[model samples]
Target: MTPNPPAVPRARLPLRAADLRGLSRLGVDAVVGVTDVVEAMHHTIASVPGIVGPAPAGRPSGITGFVYRTVRATTRTVGRGLDALWAAVPFDTTASTPEREAFVAALNGVWGDHLADTGNPLAITVSLRVGGRPYREALATPTGRLLVLVHGLAMNDLQWTRRGHDHGQALARDLGFSPVYLHYNSGRHVSQNGRAFAELLDELVAGWPVPVEELVILGHSLGGLVARSACHLGAARPWMKALSRLVFLGTPHHGAPLERGGRLVDAALGLSPYAAPLARLGKARSAGITDLRFGNLQDADWQHRDRHSQTRDDRAPTPLPAGVATYLVAATKAGRPIGLHGATAGDGLVPLASALGEHRSPALALKVPASHRLVVASANHWDLLDRPEVYRKLRSWLR
Candidate 1:
């Protein structure tokens, strides 16, 4: 007779064993990466005369190279030892705290692509959650009307509840719709997450306890871009049939200048050989963040291209999904609409024209009816999350 498998131990609050192991491994990687950067800097400085020559390729020679190599090897050895030590233990994750979730979410937003590529335990898996727990377990009685809330970059579903107010909960209370939050890694490419999301939605609708009557998605910041990507990719999928409305809050439909500014910094650093190696540090940002530079939604937009290279907006125009009711909401820090301040009035992150999907090229513009668009003055990007005015607009439109 075959014996039953050993039970995996569960722990409450703080963090999981896997989280610590992943972090330790990341620390080792960070050390190795920094050592490489330092070595490159040293080599460039040594090779360049008067600090103005073309940077040489590859690692340094002799003692310096040996020291850098040794550091990396030793770090990897320690990382392997930690991995084995942790593997010897029988603990598995069962629960997570809000703080832990936030930390992991932010880490994913920054190094999520790396974490995922390395199969790090800290990598966040896309999941449908209710009240910060798995929706399947928490959803006791599923309703026909489903309201899906998607959060922005560097954020988890738990962050949907801010300042003791949650937009999903409010909608649930005001209406009969059941709320489900999408939690995913925000460091991957928008297209990748979008494809995953589209598939997840298909599974959700197929397995829903009741026949789904109405499906609405309310996305904030990068969440809106993800939703758009999903809709574009899943046009032929069954979930698209149930999708009734797509609402975007402060979505950078055209692109965000902040990421463009970051690119400018990269370009500036590349001007000097001494600073060229340091430019790699900025280039290390996640693909998702880079996608915001031009609101890239398809893999073709980034595939086989240097993402860090400064280039004009060449994204294929993706208009609002056909036959779906769409709404747009934008925020502005300025007090009024017309003036010098109004010329650049944005939510401190995304510009008004971008958020409103207004583009110089007609093909790129997302044509939403004027009635479906709202611009909230004196409100910043985050204010769109739970602002009273914004909530009212959402309730009215959703109702």
Candidate 2:
């Protein structure tokens, strides 16, 4: 066999792998955290002398005024939207009358939180009217296996639009396999969104256009964990019986060691002047972790679902269910340390071993050659879901 070549070099984030865990568990879902966004924005402005200092001639007086006006306009718009939403809440907790009762009844009728688009990074699924499209909202139907690809944090479904020449739609065209892209809030707790995700799957599977012969779930980073959890939760349903294969791409199966970095940031931020909006991030069993762990929802073991969630603290990854045939595609290149936190090994987001779990350990994990590469020409965590190597493997696996 050809010897493995030297690893590619890239700029490294100071954050350790162990410390950079699923931030959604800390509650930073979809993409980057708010504070980090603010910080990045702040740094961007600070670095630009023109942005931080006085405006150019014929422009607003100073940078502060510019910032204020810009911020004010944006905030005003958002504030009005929030006000309308709150006004629509239909409830008066202080009142004790028929109107309150009616409001409660109406509120109870409203089961789920509004799926508002707040520039949420988790909104990866492309919204298309279902009538004439190949796919919508991860909907799958049987003519053959329907593969739904879910991406991780800071990513969108467009990642899987295609690999090289082969894309999600192409897979459906050539291989007789159906492909759907999944997108959600990566910043939310894994289990919390996973639970809702399960519900969504239940709906999709139940309404599948044809008898779903099989389901192939492919997820990267946090999406992998969520996918597994979803499968477990759907086990009892008749629709779940159609699930045949599972694939995890750079998922932090046992939590990323780097998660600790967010925890530390939360700690430091708490002591600093920027404590108000950040207090939620630093707490133990943070919002991010909670989202993955059921979001304060009860974990009844009636079906033995979510059992893997039990040993998350263990160093090694756990095995998947007995019947399911699972596959893992790992990143061996230089980037973030997977599980060791600050130390190096595997990719930054997922440890090679962890990404594979027990069934698809790194030993058999395959690599994608550069000639056929696209966005993931041997890139990092973000590429696994969108690149050709991954999509190629998934298409074949589904077949």
Candidate 3:
């Protein structure tokens, strides 16, 4: 008989006596608040261009597009490794010690420091505004339902309001739902931060200054998975009972072909150490490269772990406590070409067929559209996160 896999430690679940010393000695158990992740992203983006060397020291600005993006991606891989180390003790010393507190405080400061540099969340109310208007006004009026908007990998909340795409705030203003933003490492495993997300949700909901009638989540691409993980893990806790709705836009319900993409990239880059590092960055898994890199979360055999373990398909439709409604939005536009080379499904990162939650049995499915991945014009993985269309549909559904 296949022996049950030795139990892995989850932050919220009870820890074994043997592991308690390890866990507590561990400061915070890699509790990746979206705030921490957003801060990390700020540091990364702010430093990337310089680290990549915009012109390679006096060279003409003719840095080829391919070379620039490649170097930029390489810098991202390095930054991600640093983020991973910051997630946990990294060293063998147990977290129970006071040293753990210092480490925890340092990691916590990562976001805090970045927020300070950027002024702050409140500063966003002013510094983050565009066209002399604030985003919170859309739905943050005295009597508005709180709606949280989450972004996907490689982007931030400001991206949501850039130029022609002010979806989150617009929804808040139009539907009378207050918009809250979620920031996290989308490239990381969906489950690594699941428990933390649950706790964050509890903190967000339980700590609401004013009573919020509803708590709705709109997650794009990887954000959807984060939202899903939060729902499942938080259900095991006390506060999520108030969460009312969830909306997924182009999220990879099943693991995206990204793993498949990773394999191809790995093979294409074999032998060169650069290829090895790229494989680590591009490898697709639930916990993400953050685990493999910083050695924070437990690692599964990237090449062969069970797909089910990587994703949360085991969830029962009725599993979510009654009261919350679930909705899905998918993109069919492929990054590949059309006619002779046009792709059939997905918006690059996620397959169109897979993005729709066909497998979620008896969950609160939507009546808004028919089954297949409808072509979302000019859509791609990143676009799903910031797409105006997505926010429009998401706001309507979340409302």
Candidate 4:
């Protein structure tokens, strides 16, 4: 009798293996970036006639050129060999874990453009997920009421279920609304992602198996900015008619203090010629990170200017959509005796005023009525995701 076929070794997940390759590429790029910085410093110093003279105008000897070429060719060959080896290995897509997926999403949020342009395996494509499956397959029948949950920077849809609970799942079970999680590369420009998201929603609505009755969006942190951006761009789309409510959780409507501080660091580094090259390190953060400096949601906000420049907040005001119920949730670390200072201090990353859309300029301020705003005391930022009290407030509003 023929013995059972030898058991096959389970292959690693494609993305997990690809992450290794992506990291290798990042190492190569880091080496190249350092070399470029050093070369630039050399050029800057040599150009100063008083301090240093330019080298004689002569090409390197044929032997030196050959050596350089050989080194470059060897490097390229090794890189290619590694890539080929990774490609040859089989991968089980089912092995993709939530932790690995979240880590990759964060990397994409930081260096997504590079990954997309180079067709790297680390780039995440935006899609709607239902029951942990792609929308197309999972959403066979539409439950009129739809709730879309968008995650913050360096996060993925899987991250929504935090500490044994997810607002989306609870809302669906409690309110009979269908919950959909958005997966996207958080590293891309907010406006760019916004536009794509608007288009994607338009298609989603049009393709629904059943009529869509009401649509609600719950966005956290930077996700709120993206949601607002999409609404601005898709104001005239048919799907807008179905949009009923928008809820922002710990979102920075004006800007985040962390990114603004990064800008200050970049400017300080630029003050010294010797240290200017180091500024590139700060500026190397993804466009998504830079856009947070002023909560930029439109292309005009960043179009032609130096993104790293210490410029005034010139982002065009994007007011909340009319006819839609807008809600703001701001969290603070301090409890009961929460004074103005504690409120302004916010949940550590976002200030209370910013989260509440309190801009000095009326034109830029989001007109969310006092009744629609909720402040969670003694809660940090991430707590907004799974706190029982927070869920109670959401249920009250959405119900």
- List lDDT for all candidates, in order: 0.88, 0.48, 0.48, 0.82
Task: State the local distance difference test value for candidate 4.
Answer: 0.82
Task: Specify the highest-TM-score model's number.
Answer: 1
Backbone-clash count (model 4): 1
RMSD of every prediction? 7.7, 16.8, 19.4, 6.3
Candidate 3, residues 278-303, lDDT tens digits: the string is 33323323334322221122123223
Candidate 4 per-residue lDDT over residues 1-399, each given as its tens digit: 999999998744345566777776766666656654654455455444233233323223467545545655666677778888877767746556775776788898788866777777777888888755797787654688988898899898888988999998899889988888888888888998889889888988888777899999999999999999999999999989999999999999998989989999988876655566677777878888888888999999998988878469988888899999999999998874168878677999999988999998998998788889889888888999998988998999999
- Model 2 per-residue lDDT tens digits across residues 200-268: 777766766777778777776667876766765555666567777777777766455555445456555
Q: After superposition, how far is residue 54 of candidate 4 from its true place, in Å?
A: 18
Prediction 4 TM-score vs. true: 0.87
Local lDDT at 31 for model 3? 28
Q: How many residue pairs clash in each candidate?
A: 0, 41, 14, 1
Residue 110 in model 1: lDDT: 86
**For candidate 2, what is the lDDT?**
0.48
Q: What ranges in model 4 sit over 4 Å off?
A: 1-15, 42-77, 139-141, 336-338
Question: Which is superior by lDDT, 1 or 4?
Answer: 1
Candidate 1, pairs of clashing residues? none
